[model samples]
Target: MITTLLVANRGEIARRIFRTARAMGLATVAVYSDADADAPHVREADQAVRLGPAAARESYLNVEAVLAAARATGADAIHPGYGFLSENAAFAEVVTAEGLTWVGPPPAAIRAMGLKDAAKALMIAAGVPVTPGYHGESQDPAHLAREAGSIGYPILIKAVAGGGGKGMRKVERPADFTEALGAAKREAAAAFGDDRVLLETYVARPRHIEVQVFGDAHGQVVHLFERDCSLQRRHQKVIEEAPAPGMSDEVRQAVCAAAVRAARAVDYVGAGTVEFIADASAGLRADRIWFMEMNTRLQVEHPVTEAVTGQDLVEWQLRVAGGEPLPLTQDEITLNGWAMEARLYAENPAAGFLPSIGELEHFVLPESVRVDTGVEAGGAVSPHYDPMIAKLIAHGPSRRVAAHRLAAACAQVQVWPVRTNAGFLARCLEDADFLQGEVDTGFIAARLDALAGALAPSDQVLAAAAQGLLSQTPVPAAEPQGPWSALTGFRINGPRQGQVRLYRDGQAVTAPLVDGPLSADVLLNQAGAIVVFEAGEAFAFTGSPPQAITGEGPAGDGVVIAPMPGKVVAVAVSAGDKVLKGQTLVTLEAMKMEHALTAAFEGVVETISVAAGDQVSEGVVLARLTPSA
Candidate 1:
């Protein structure tokens, strides 16, 4: 019997596991780094221990520190709630070797599905169909080139030890194969410490479908249906739904059966996911869906599966880890309703989806949906981790209703200073094609322009903001359009109608201020900045605008700046290089992901401020550009 459980991860996932552990009458412990001292998960745990500094290697990823924390807290069980070391086989081995219960699959199972090449071979031997690709142990570029030719043009180079969108690239022609392979290998080495790659035939119209399966030490394994995660941007999943739209009964049965078989072949235990890539040209046929890979841990989108199936998967994991039999047989598991989850990231979609990190001065998620978040009103989003703010999940009787509710909830998100992808997610959920279930893996990329467009402040919203600013600062008496017209000479008895000009995102707009209180959507931050909320987006405006001499005047500058603190991986351009707008100039790695800073305008590089491997801070100018001669 497990009396104390320690979650070896952070953020919302750790809190989620603690909730389940509490329900089972078990003490919960949380381990946090220096950067997470005041984090919600740390405060929520029954006992918390300090790991180390902010860097993951010195903290979360340090096996010794994690084990020491567990020892100090007297935790008999460890639940790695995805990411970090959740799928690390060696970590699992160490935990069990120390006489502590590992709330996950056997280490052998993790190793079996750890590398893409080995997992593909294992799945083939388990009678599960896999995508046509090369899974051999050859690093020769010429050999992989030959294999790519055999697979035909438009092949996908995937890092054998990678997940998410990193260490992956698509080659459309033979000429681009070498470069793409090298790039993929470099990223693979950086992310997974393995530069080995596997090739696959790129599915023409692909849909991502994965089955949630659970197994026990008693040789019992059952699947909890499937989730469709076709909506993605830059190969990262943004939204996921249960009971994949357009999935027929036959297809679900075939995939789930294969998933169970795959688990049995590896003697898997606890929560695992079997992912498949389906060619949607024919609308989700059993024969067209091919095995992708298996996740040897709980997934980020598990809430959707739990909602649709009406099961507490964490309870199942705890029971299985305690040497219990499967909670329910496959026949008893039933899919009830349609559910969807949207990952709200701290990023500005209008600004190349650049990650934003700052204090969450005022954060409010909709009460209408199930919100899983790690930060609260005063918490800050650090640059040392993933930028996801929260996850909003909604369930309904049908897919359309679920989408509607989810979209509404996303639009209702209230966050300031730190930008969020909520507005972008809401637009995606309300897209007509998305509503009709006519989506594929490329759905988000195709509609990114229409969905991520900047939220322009309407006339009413602008007026409300002006009113808010006027109410704070006494109304001016003369020179209605002067620089201090909105701030000088108080007029307590004059006509309430006063015009004030405010600048937002470097664009100047004038609106008439009225009497009475400011609108509900208008807010005043600590710095006295007027912020207007619309469709889950916060637009800050100021009465005093900066001089319009920088870059494109009234719209910021032509200097390329780092969005967050990161290590510069490469400098693609030097001083005096004539570059086109949107050309990649520098690439940096931060939060375990890569970001390529591009030229903001067609110009000649005037100066390079940073070099390769140099660490930079947020808002630091990386390179300066002047108009082309």
Candidate 2:
């Protein structure tokens, strides 16, 4: 039995694992980099050890550093909390070789299911259904293009070595295949160090469903039902729920049974997920479902499953790793209620979901839900890691109640300075199609405009901002001050209604406020104020001196700047080159994704400021353009 545990990851997931370990009376150890020395996870652990710099490769991904920390801390086991090196076979093997408990699936199973192509072959041999695709060893561009032609149009190119939509692209036409393939290969090589890819027939309207299966050394393998992760943007899950809606009894049984068969075939022990893609074009059917891939580690969306089933999966992992039998039989485990989770990320939705990095300034969550986060009100959101702020989970006896409650909670959350996707998530929950169980992988893509569009501040929101600004100014004890004091709208003649111009997201709004006693319900901090009104979310605003602001540079200035702090991965333009509007000029990579900076208007390149492989800061000009002569 293990008495001490070391977590081999960082951020919220690491903090989550430590919560269970501390509750179970086990001494917990946390590994962090220089960037996370002041992080919440470090404070939560009983002990922490510094690995190295902020770059993941130098710290969390360094297997030797993690192992050394475990040894130094005298930890008896290591729990890799679902990212970085969690699914690495060599890491697991080394842990077991060193006589430490590996709190995950066996190394053999991880290796077998590491690559998408090899895993599909293994699943096929195990009699599990798979999607139609070319998962061959040949990776020649010409050969793959030929295979794609034979397979048909509208195909998906995916990285065989990684998941999370890193190296995935959808080609809708033959003319775009080459470009898509090159992008997929580049991303795959950067993320997984493997440039190999696979081609698969695209499912137009697909529901992404996966089964949660657990096994122990006693030869007992049982499934914990299914979760629907179809609500996604850019192939990354935005929202997830347990017990897929519209699932029939027959289809559920068939899918779960197949998942069990796949797990047992690999002699899997511990928690694993068997993901499937169901063709929901005509609604869900057992015959229309096919295997996509298997994740040999605990998933990020595991909390919803726990909420519906009343089980702590982390506890199960601990016990199973200590040679315990399955806690419950297949027939004993049953789902009780509906659960939903919304991932709150630090991103600006109106700016094409570009990540926003800065101090959190203020962080508050509703009391009605379960919130898992690793940052506090004064914490910093660094550019060196993923920008997810928290996971808000809600559970109710029915799906409708759960969905509505979760949506309200998402909207009620208040995070300042660093913007979030809270409003965007609320729109998705309130959407008519989503509430009616009409979700699919393509649902977000189809309705992105309606869901993530720029939100205009309402009249009430503007009024609240005005009220907050007035409340901050001090009232004079002596009457009859200078005219400058009247800026507060403190006119002695009758009720004075004055306007205040507030700028938000680069737009200005003028709000009218009446001179009166301020309300005591306003919440304020050094950075801003949050005013709560009737039936509306607490409006967060910061007071700015009145001025006419021009959001653009001076006339004739056409400079392309980096949107975020990232490494310059590619530069496609040079000085003296004519460019068209919206043409890709450079690609900046941050948070494990690439973002292309495009030309704002047609012009000639005046100068190039940066080159490929150079690290650049946010708003640094990469290229400048002038009108063609």
Candidate 3:
């Protein structure tokens, strides 16, 4: 039996594993990087070890360091809690070779499915359904172009080792294939250290369904049904649910059976995920499902599966690692009710989903739902890791109720000081298509504008603002004090009217405040209506004063700089290159993702500030694109 376990990862996943280990009476150890020194997972564990530097490559990805920590801490086992080196075959091999229990699938299974191209080949040999595409080993650009042409338009260029949408592009037209390939290659090289890519015929309106499979050393494997992860952004899953909505009983059984077969073929032990792309355009059908890829570790959206199945997957992993037999038979296991999970990220939805980094001043969520979070209030969202804040999950008797409850829980979350995708998630849940189970991978892209628009301040938000203002005791009517008070001018009689600027969702609005105990009037600029508030709280606005009454002009010659530390991955233009308005000039890779820095207007590249592979910090000038002469 494993008495002590070291989790070779950080954030919510580490915390999650620690929760189960502690409950099972096992000592839990946490490994953290410099940036995550004060992270929640570190505090939650019985013992914590510093791996190395803040960068993932230096810290979590350093398999030797993680194994060394396990040895130093005398941990009997190591549980790689997803991402980083979790799926790295070498890491698993080293752990078992060191006489330590590896609380995941065998290294052989990981190696078998580590690369998508190789995994597809293995699946084909295992008699599993595979997508029709070019999974060849050729890397020649022209060869790929020809393959794309033969595959016809609307093809997907995917990295052989890619996951999380990186190094993947959808080409809707033949003319855009080359450019898309180049972009995908750049991303793939930056992300996976491999530029090898594959091509697949893009399925129209496909639903992403993945099965959770577990195995034991006793030669038994079982699946925990399926989860619908069709709601995605840029190929990364945003929302997931168990017992996929709109799934037919026949198709569900077939998918589960296929997943079990795939696991059995690899002799998979512990937890693994088999993802498949289903052609839901014609409804769920066994013939329409095609194997996508396999994730060899626990998934980020596993909470929904746990909620519906009432199983502690981590405990099962530990049992399986101890050479135990399968916990339950396929016929004995059953899923109840419905569950949903929404990934809450620190990102600006309107700003091309660019990751946001800053201090989390006030991070509060509802207690009605399960929230798996890594950071705490006062923790900084460093630019060294994924910008995910938490995963919120809700379970109910029905899918509709679960979605509605989950949305409500997300909306009630109070996270300030850093922008998040909370508003956008709430809007998606309330969307008619999502509510009716009519969704696919292109759901978010097709409804991007509407979702972004829905993030605007609603009447309830304005009421909260009113309550915030009234609760504030204005400066004495006798004397004008600071800049804010002086600008308003003191009044002896009647309610003193002052214009206060407010910022929300990256937009500014001026609220005309009528200094009253109750019943204050606020005129919203965009709504063009005066809202009467009975009682409200003042919403604290940060950054510079509102632009409405400040008459502040735009910084014409000022350069927009990177707000956090990162690496420059792409320089689209040379020093003398000319660019049009809003044209991309450089793409920065930070926190394991890419962010494009585009031109503010038509300009000539005056100075190429940074090159690919250069590490940058906040305010670093990546480029200087001067206005046209």
Candidate 4:
């Protein structure tokens, strides 16, 4: 029996595993990085160990450090929660060799599905439906290019060892193939240490569907239906749902059967996911589904699967690791309801979704839905790891009801100090197309402008602010006789303004507070809101804030600036270089993503404030462009 288990990962997954382990009367241990010393997961564990510095490579990715941590904690087993090294076959091998129970699939299974190319070949041999692509061992650039041409234009160059869209590129035309290939190769090499890539025919309007399959030492495998992860941005899933909206009974059976076959092909002995890309433009058809890749570990969106299936996957993982046979049969397992999960990220929706980093001042979510969060109030969102704040999941009798409930929960959340995707996610759930289940990979991309536009602060927000202010005991009409009251100055018939600045969407606005008993008017130049207090502290707003003042205020001279913290990746112009309006100026790499800072008007580069390698903070002057004379 596994008495003590050490999770070799951090954040929500670690906490999630610990929750299940503890419930099963197993001791739990947590490993944290320098930045996560006081993290919630670290505090929740029975014991905690420090791995190393904040950088993932020095901490979570260091195999030796993790092994040492497990050993030092006297942990009898190691559970590699998804992400850091969960699918690393070598890590699993080391754990078992060291006489530690590995709470995951066998290392051989991981090795078989570790690389996409090899996995595709194995799946084909197992009689599973594989996509038409070049999954060979050829690394010759010219030969690969020729293969891509033969496959046809608009081929997808994907790294064999890639996941999470890191080493993937969609080349729409032959003219752009070379550059896309080079970029994908470079990214693949950096991320996976393997530069080999494969080309596949690009499917337009593809719906990403995957089956959750589990196996045990008893040679039994059962699938938990399917999840539709079609709503994506930059190949990263933003929303996921179970029992795909438009799936037919025949296609669902085929997908589930194929997933089980793929798992059986590798002698799998734990939880795994078999992903498929379906051509949804023609609706759900068995012939239209093709295998994409298999995820060797639990997925981030597993909560939705659990909610709908009413199962704890972590417990199953632990049980399988303990050499137990499959406890449940296919007929015994059943899906009860529709479930949806939305990833709430600390990011700016209007600013190309750049990851936002800061302390979570006030993080409050409604109790109507289940929220699995890694960070808590006052927790810092560092740049060292992914900036996901939480995963909000909702379950209902129907998909539409679940989606709507999840959206309402997200909008009701009040988070400050860091910009979040809550507003944007709420808008997406309320979107007509999304509500109708007409979703695809291009959903977000096609409706980005409308989504961003919906992030504008609503009148309800202004009313909330007013209510917050009104809740405070009415500032004495006349100066009170206490030290706390000294700060409140009173003058008859003389108006005094208290300036309060609040940040929204990366821009700070100073609202002049005009104090009154029943009402307060917050004015900022011409854009102001008259907040009327009702029912003691409630407030009602009259008009919307001006749109022109939403962006950065005048900087005394003609210059736009980088509005958030990031690293400069490109400097498109030198001093005295002439540029056109909306010309690309500098590309800032932040939160492991790239964003281009463009010129606001036709101008000349008067002063280059930063270089390519410089790290910048919010409101930093990156480059000054002088308007044309």
lDDT of 2 at 196: 95
Query: Model 3 off-target regions past 4 Å?
Result: 454-456, 470-560, 627-629
lDDT of 3 by residue, 6-74 (tens): 999888899888999989899988999998899889988888999999878899898888888888899
lDDT of 1: 0.89
**Candidate 2: deviation at residue 338, Å?**
0.4
Q: Identify the leading candidate in terms of TM-score.
A: 1
What TM-score, over all chains together, does every model reach?
A: 0.93, 0.93, 0.89, 0.84
Residue runs of model 1 more than 4 Å from their true location after superposition: 474-499, 512-520, 547-558, 574-581, 600-607, 624-628
What TM-score should be assigned to candidate 3? 0.89
Q: Go through the candidates in order and give each one's C-alpha lDDT.
A: 0.89, 0.86, 0.81, 0.81
Query: Which digits, one per residue and each the tens of the lDDT, describe model 4 over residues 248-361?
Result: 888899999999999999999989999999989978889989999999899999988999889999999999999998768999889988999999888877767878788875
Residue 253, candidate 4: alpha-carbon lDDT: 92
Candidate 2's clash total is 0
- Residue 575 lDDT in model 1? 95
Candidate No. with top lDDT: 1
RMSD of each: 3.4, 3.7, 5.4, 6.9
Point out where model 2 deviates above 4 Å.
Answer: 474-498, 505-507, 514-557
* Higher-ranked by TM-score: 1 or 4: 1
lDDT of 1 by residue, 1-629 (tens): 89999999899999888998899999999999999999999999999999999988899999999999999989999999988899999999999998999999999999999999999999999999999999999999999999999999899999999588789999999999997897788788888889999999999999999999999999999999999999998788999999999988988899899999999989999999999999999899989989999999999999999999999999999999999999899999999989999999999899888888889988989999999999999999988888887889999999999999999999888898889999899999999999999999999888878999876777677778877777787433325465645443346678555566787777777766665554448778788778888777788987776566543221126777877899998898889899998888898988777888888778999889999889998768888888776
* Ranked by TM-score, top first: 1, 2, 3, 4
Weakest lDDT window of 10 consecutive positions for candidate 4: 533-542
lDDT, model 3: 0.81
